[model samples]
Target: MRRPHRVAVLLVDPVVGFDAAIAPTLFGAAEADGEPLYEVVTCSATGGQVASTNGFALVPQAGPEALDDADTVIVPGTRNAAVRRDGRLDDAVGAAVARIPATARTVSICTGAFVLAAAGLLDGRRATTHWRHADALRALHPAVDVDENVLFVDGGDILTSAGLAAGIDLCLHIIRRDHGGQVANAVARFCVVPPWREGSQAQFIEAPLPHDDSASTAATREWACAHLQEPLTIEQLAAHAGMSTRTFIRRFREETGQPPGVWMRSRRLDRARELLEARTLSIDEVARRSGLGSGANLRHHLRRGLGMSPTSYRKAFADREFTDA
Candidate 1:
């Protein structure tokens, strides 16, 4: 049997307790064929007690040594003075971060990007943090491209997420990327969270709630998901919702933080990905079923969105049995 992937979460002093817990909870729930897929360990600079912003302390299971053989290393949000203020890593924290193997993927949640930036791990990379702190991050580390709009930025080897709940999105995304959508969806089901939220969705929505409580585009969204194989237009959707085209478009953007057409395209792409990962359908068949029109269209969108062909995506995530069901 293949060994489970090893994940080391390095908790900095005064860590955001919520951020520190997300990885262990989500990664622990991922499994294949009734076997765990990841072995997560919580560690700190010296294996000693660490302070948290939540009025408590954390006693990690290990020290910096845990990072030596880790497949991935994560840093949760922190209020560490040096890193947060002057963009300099604390000596002990710097040493701990340097111990992470060069090949190991690195991640940060919320202000944890500060630590990564201070360590120079995010240099010349596009990353994000909590929107409130985005300016500070950019001012401190001008070499890092800081985008505060999206929920997270996946820079391949170094990934960074926005505030608290966005951590869940990033972790699920990691699971989906590493295994397949099926495994990620199983984990999401167990955790009682939505299966997927596009990373490009706005981090701070101007109007998350509908102005009229009696009306919502949610049902229309569900209906649209069911009918993705058809060409769905704003007029048809508005007719179904008993609203004018303008109102439907406005409400759709207000509720989903994306315009109607963009949201629909993203949904179609998601469907195509699921088909690719879980079935043996031909490229054209997958395209038709997912409403992407043809093999050429599907290939175009897949390459444009994910930089991979349908066959390559299937080979990366296929043939895995999800036992969580």
Candidate 2:
């Protein structure tokens, strides 16, 4: 019998309620066969009690001592300013964190990245934190490459997330990594959240201004989706929106953080994914319908973006309910 994965969540003083609760809900609720997949526990610096930023106090059964045996340790966001300002961690907190086995994977939710950086674990690694703190975090730790965009940064053993709901995205990504997409999709269905967002996306995106006032890009977006099966060029998209190609390209980037070609490729991949999942289409057929032009094109783009063959993705995630037909 294989040992269950052990997950320990470190709840520092004045912990953010949302970040603190994600690990338990995600890992505790996931199962393999008949038993739970992970042994989840929450811990604190001291053995007694820890207060949340929300004004409630809760006690954990374990202290930092629990981290001694943990396979993964997560540090959640905290309201404590010392961690934010000077990247300062209390001596005990620092000691307890260092006690976690060097081989054990570490993750930080939101501002918790500050704590990890202060401990020198994130040095020279690509990481992310809450968008509001990204500049500050980078300024404080020059050794860390801070990407304010994206919901999370998965540095293999060490992971970090943007503030608030991005924590959910990070947790689900971890789920996908440990198990597979089938399990991750199931968990997402249960949790009422999108199953995946590329970890490279921005934390907060500004939507186009309201529909009543201006010639926003929303109409052009609708047109693009409707014509997804046909090859689209930026100039054509611009023409449809009654704007010059350069202006349209600029606005598209402002609205979608990605270049037009990249965005079109992502959309094609998504269309191909749906066909692969919903219908047993040949690779060529899926490619044609998604406007990638050829099976080789489909294979190249899918492998580049998702790191999986269409058939493998279907078997792992799309084969279940749709197989009934």
Candidate 3:
């Protein structure tokens, strides 16, 4: 009989509940052809009950002894200000983590990154946290490259995700990478979550504040939407918002996590994606309508953003049974 992949969730004391529950809810549900693929266990430092940040506590079925057989180890987030401030792993917790076999992989959900950091696992690695805590995470572990925008960063053996639900996204992503898109999509469907997210944690914003009390960037955004086919530039977008370019640029970035030009391009690409999925329009027409002006430009961005050509993207989204031949 084939062995199920063993996953150990290392529960540090005073764990944050939201972070601790994500692994079992996500990876534990993953299956293949009606067969359970992962066996998930919760373990504490001494192999007994662990207290939560809340008043309650949890009885871990396994102790650190479970780490001996783990194929993967996940450190769920903690709310302890000390961990958040200094990335300090209590001695017992640190030793248990260090005992994982060299072949075993590791992951952190939310502020669980602190545990990983304190264990010296995240040094020289890219990581993230709740955007609100990103700067402090960096201040504590300057050796770690902190990117607050991405939902997760996959560094082969070590993975770290941003806040809360992003842990779910990372688990699904790991499942997708280990199995396939079809399986991942199936799990997503069963869970009633989106089959996929853009993955990057960056927010998409039209404007920072209302143009006036009457409306937010609604009218100006709509106007920009209608004129995407034009050579829509920062100057044009600013003018449409009835503001100077400097103010418009600042507000746009503050809101969107991207500059006006980049957001416009992303908007254009989103429309292009819709057209491609529609499959009613020819590739050239899709380009023209999405403001790329040519199929070649559309192909370039589609390949860069979606990692596929327009034809392939259309097929994947529009028809599972799609074939170019």
Q: How many residue pairs in model 3 have overlapping backbones?
A: 2
lDDT of every predicted structure (CA atoms): 0.91, 0.81, 0.78
As for lDDT, the candidate ahead, 1 or 3, is 1
Candidate 3 lDDT at 190 equals 79
Which runs in model 1 stand beyond 4 Å of their true positions?
A: 205-208, 211-215, 319-325
Q: For model 3, what is the error of residue 206's alpha carbon versus the real structure, in angstroms, after optimal superposition? A: 15
Which rank order by lDDT, best down to worst? 1, 2, 3
**Model 1, TM vs. native:** 0.93
RMSD of each: 2.6, 5.0, 6.7
TM-score of each: 0.93, 0.76, 0.66
Q: Write the per-residue lDDT of candidate 2 for residues 137-235, one digit (tens) a residue.
A: 998899999998878988889999998888888988887767665566777888888676667766655455545424566688767867888878888
lDDT minimum window of 10 residues, candidate 1? 316-325
Measured by lDDT, the strongest candidate is 1
What is candidate 1's lDDT per residue for 1-325, written digit by digit as tens?
6678899999999899999999999999998778899999999998999999999899999999999999999999999999999999878999999999999999999999999999988889999999999999999999999999888999899999999999999999999988888889999999998778888787864455666645898888889999999998899999988889998888777677799998999889989999998768999999999999999999999999999999888876654433222
- Please give the lDDT score for candidate 2: 0.81
Q: How far out, in Å, is residue 2 in model 3?
A: 2.6
